[model samples]
Target: MTIRAWPSRRLGAGGLAAGALALAPVAAAEALYVPEAEPVADGVYAIIGPTDARTYENHGMNANYGIVETGEGVLLIDSGPTAFSAELIEEAVAEVTEAPIRWILNLGVQDHRWLGNDYFQREHDAEVIAFEQTVRQQQAFATDHLEGRLKEAVQDRLAGTEPAYADRRLPGEEATLALGEVRLELQRTDAHFPGDAMAYLPEEDIAFTGDLVYVDRMLGVHPWSSVQNGYEAYQELAALDPETVVPGHGRVSGMDRVERDTGAYYEFLVHEVGAAAEDLAPLQEVVERHREEPAFQHLEHYEGWHATNVNRAYLEFQQ
Candidate 1:
């Protein structure tokens, strides 16, 4: 719970500067964190966040969350970035339905997805849920996430944000959650993060793909990322053929967009990079050969991230 005074990385332009600027003055920060509930179906809403990088201006609201009106109460898929952002999410949900938030699902261990759980649990006593592996991952990275880049970007906006692990952890790869008359089928995937998940609404035929898919922005392949596993997960989710997909980032889209943006992208990285690694191709050659990929060049941050993604995938495959 200690807000480490980590040195600001970006100094003048957008960095949380040393003194008072680090605080980001909640009023100004809140302005950019406003959650606009976009309706995906009757009573189901996607609170899409910014596709840009996390910064003080955006309050780290860089991941998408969901609000589902289950007749009896509301079911939230992935909480926002901070306590205040959670409040903003609540306000946005109020515009759509008057129901109180009953359940909050942490689709992945990502900070934005679950860091706001403490706020909702304290305020509305919402039950937080995630897969057991996800809870472990959250427990592992909670400190780093809270006190790491999130604090650097949003600074004091992350105040009062505590790591509230999921109260309910489901076992194995998948399970079905029945809330009132609504049923959300949750499946665990190993795509963007360890224990990332995607939810399918059988009634609505809509898929809430946690971090398994990124529709617009280029995905970051970290040391923990597995291109092989990610593509496999994408293939499985694609097989389900969910009519509509609420990607972890970007707009609410369909399977075609998911295939083009995430499925094909992951597949390309794994196949190309995997083949190169097996042949002992140099990392630079791999990076150079795939840097200007036409299919994904249009995505936000593609130029900046594509090479690093290729490098990471090459290293992962090499191992």
Candidate 2:
């Protein structure tokens, strides 16, 4: 993970923009679960959550979120899991800067990424932005997301989270957003979910590759993910030549980590597993052949997810 020098001049409550629209204080019990924000670049912060599966202990905060200072106000990349998590994220940002969250771009359709939109929009009057595809997917999968693993893990913590869609929708495959001095180029691709997207800071050379890049953890090839498309999307991200990468789920890192974990792993799957499937290799043989692959064994959840990834890739290429 890449760490940078912290910015000086921390702001107090009076520094909040929008007439000091700071959220009410969190209860003492929820204070303990707030994730701390770490500076990754000038006026950019990342709240690195746990790399484990969602559970009661972690309160479904297993995905990372980003805080970017846009000079005028703050821009949040991904909102947290629930209303409480959003409050916690708000408090964490308050510790770093007094700027209120003015704009939010949900990078994907995952439950944790946009579920907090309701709170931010209602409280801070921030404009929630997402791709048109993301909002469609969010509407389509709201129930399953609420009742699936998230509910099973977080239980009561899932309360108060509403299905709030984006207030502003960016259509098409690409768009550019300029907030104050910060400019972000948004690109949507079929990588992790129905509407997987990434935000790039051209001037800073920072890329917030949400789910398109994972560091210190193995990327999952879900039933909907396309290995071929994922690799192609990775190539597009690499072409940008970003100096820093804030992945969807892990610590802030450089392009090398993104290449090693996500790009190379996807390349391996498409070439090796795709070849095995083309050769009519049996499923067991394919799984066994790549079970001990050394390249990504050091990543968390490798043991649990690698085989499943191989299996999914093989199935994908078999057709």
Candidate 3:
């Protein structure tokens, strides 16, 4: 597949400056794009991309959706980006749990969190949970980015199957659930994306980190994201010390792979960006230069995202 870069159009000086000024606001737009959902753990599950959410904007990327089993029933973390994908997850959950989907925790406020509520509410009557900031991000995404894309995504979800949605609202910093002998913990971390959260199963030594950890793919950054937050988030991952780390996308890997790969990407970002900044290279040029780095060589169809990540890194370094 041909990879595409994040679109950024520059106007004349006057317009260019205005557009540049608007970068932060535009970057803040919260769009949820997820693809097909999949089963990750024995009782855990995930969906990779284009699920009921816009996938074209972020270089056709998708957020990962996860499901954890609980004693009461099942707890879903971050619904796919649309109603149809949510329906698929619901089906998957049903296979594992006869009880109703009791709690739905949105790891963050992106469309991946709230867009599929209609399905859960209508079908299984699942109650959605999210951080207060996550709710705000969802509102921002709905108002700023979800209009056209959301409609298309929702329609796409409804195309081949019955329509669905869920009931949703904001949640607290930490929430716990019991599923037989397993205990699931949903904890918030201020990294990667703002208001990001993780699902931890201490018993399994497995952690579901949304976009916070990318196994082999390059991480995304925006003008609104804090470089420190990204760094600190990595540190948090180091602290969790999970045996298995399931990223928002890509294959599941050990904690060592998670730490090494994530750290390598960040280190590459800092080093490369520093060099580019020292020479005062433009973002586009910097992106082109590192398009073939060894660290990113194995990513499937990654050129488009590599350029975008480079641009993001340049922007982060500038700040």
Cα lDDT for residue 302, candidate 3: 60
Alpha-carbon local distance difference test for all models: 0.84, 0.84, 0.61
Worst 10 residues of 2 by lDDT: 1-10
Among all windows of ten consecutive residues in candidate 3, which has the lowest summed lDDT? 6-15
Specify the highest-TM-score model's number.
1
For model 2, what is the C-alpha lDDT against the true structure? 0.84
Backbone collision tally, model 1? 0
TM-score of 2: 0.89
Residues 122-196, candidate 3: write the lDDT tens digits: 666677666676666556556543455555644433332222222443367666756556686777665666777
* Residue runs of model 1 more than 4 Å from their true location after superposition: 1-31
lDDT, candidate 3, equals 0.61
Displacement of residue 271 (Cα, Å) in model 1 is: 1.3
Error of 2 at 225 (Å): 1.6
RMSD of each: 6.9, 6.2, 13.0
Q: Distance (Å) between predicted and true CA of 65, model 1? A: 0.8
- Model 1 scores worst on lDDT over the 10 consecutive residues at 1-10
